[model samples]
Target: MSSVLAKVDWKSQGFRYFPLKLHYQRLFATRVQKISLDGGFTCPNVDGTVAIGGCTFCDNRAFSPSRRVRRDAIQAQIERGITGLRRRYKLEKFIAYFQPATNTYGPLDKLKTLWDTALEDPRIVGLVVGTRPDCVPDEVLDLLDEYAQKTYVSLELGIQTIHDASLHWMNRGHDHAVSMEAMQRVTDRGFEVSLHVMLGLPGETSEMMLQTADQVAKWNPAGVKLHNLYAVERTPLADQVRAGEVRLMELAEYIQILADFIERLPEQIVIERISGDAPPKNLVAPEWCLHKGSIIRSLTDELVRRDSYQGKNCRMQGLPREPS
Candidate 1:
């Protein structure tokens, strides 16, 4: 290498390879807000259709703020949320994200009422329903499709991994087949789909993570959330971490794996989020990855340093055919 090139320090350069939030803001032409609504949705695992206690690594308490889970009418929750947000940010349009649990696991009208309540607020642009793949039904899909005609609607399906063994170990109620079927069904109805996939699951190698990204990109989803697995306090995985029964990847190692994952993903996929959101207070393991945007920043720096970019592996990848 040239002496001049060798002296160039990327650490000092400070540039991000893939900045996504800017793209979202540009599309909105303002601060596009996300108000997480509990909506009192319950998981299938806890509902006894699958298992109990939800995922072995899940603690909804860690994810929800106090205001989000208030036991009140859905409209009241939105009003209170908006009333609180009135001070800091003037967000004219927001996404009502049903974040706590499986949003589609209810009677058609019951679910419809919960969702329609969100639309009553003029500030609300649309709905962002978070649910397991298996929880979605035709009746729900029809509602989402019709809602999309009136406003923006994006379904965030938690298709964590394509590996069955990993799902089993994580106590995820549904399998990969369920995820595929859900995505196919959601897409066929012309509603936007954003998949939630995590990296570094138990027994899942980096190659397997890349395979999941390949499948997701091919599936023609509008958005994607790439999260890292962390052992949260009070979860079964935390016990394994304390006992040294489960291995946790270091931040740097995870960043390298995630860089590869990003390169394999399609550029068109709106990356909603890059890292897991386990606050230091609630996180029990993999403590090194808790420095907020450290993982995402490191991943971007690595990508730029390696001169890598997303969709670099698109042509060679044999992904399932979805609508163009």
Candidate 2:
């Protein structure tokens, strides 16, 4: 560890890792929340532009709350999300997250209309767009750049794993090279980028997962969201789990793996999400995933036991350090 890393106190921060909430507070000087919005977008993989049948593990409704309910206009969805979020959190500012599906997989004009409508609301402080790595073309990035000049903008790319075989097994439609190219373009435009990484994918070993973390550390993205692969209803993964073709990670094993993975990442990256879960009705396996609180608690305990914090092992692993 460097001198700075040694002098810091992790426990005082209430988390073993740098969390997204803290990152937002430092940037906006206020509490911020993300409101999920269904932009009525679909993926090229699903529409047969690139391939058929979306990712094996994907069922938009299971991952995005906005997709489960009745479809509404973009503005209406924002209003409804705000109303619901207000009841849960005492925050005023929010980011319009075009979540659900490939948010940037449409015509430039249509994309502009939806995004502009959300920003029209003063309460929406930023925009977080989720899409596949191959979906964001240069023109789409240019449009996002226009927004970045006006307000906060984050382009979330689903780089599930860097392994080509795992991607093929999941039918991700694109290779790891595509993901790398997308990250380069987005970061080159000075956009804040968040990478989504999935763990516990079938056939990935602990060494392979750590390798993905190492690559992510090298990318030095602004944020990262980590989650174990869990099966949900109406998805191919569920059927695989039923047929014993796939096995989900147990809670304890995942905690250890996740902690190890985080330690390999640089401390500057905001840990956007520690785990993912779905509605009870949609969730199919690893019943423990539904209990998010327990998962978090266990992760914290494991980190404490190891006397570790985020990036504690970075230097030992010869990972690149963030520029001072």
Best by lDDT: 2
TM-score of each candidate structure, all chains considered together:
0.85, 0.90
Expressed as tens digits, the lDDT of each residue in 1-324 for candidate 1 is: 011112112223353333445434544556766788877666768766787777988875433212233334777777777777766787677778788777887778767777777887788877889888998888888888888777767788899999999898888977888988877788755566888888888788878888887787778576788877889888888999899998888888788887787777765555678777787898987777667567666877788788876666654344432321
RMSD of each: 7.8, 4.6
Tell me the TM-score of model 1. Answer: 0.85
How would you encode candidate 2's per-residue C-alpha lDDT over 139-229 as one tens digit per residue?
9999898888788888999998999999999999999999888888887564678999999998999999999998998888878999999
Runs in model 1 with CA error above 4 Å?
Answer: 1-23, 60-72, 83-90, 316-324
lDDT score for residue 169 of model 2: 96
Cα lDDT, model 1, residue 281: 92
Off by over 4 Å in 2: 1-12, 60-72, 315-324
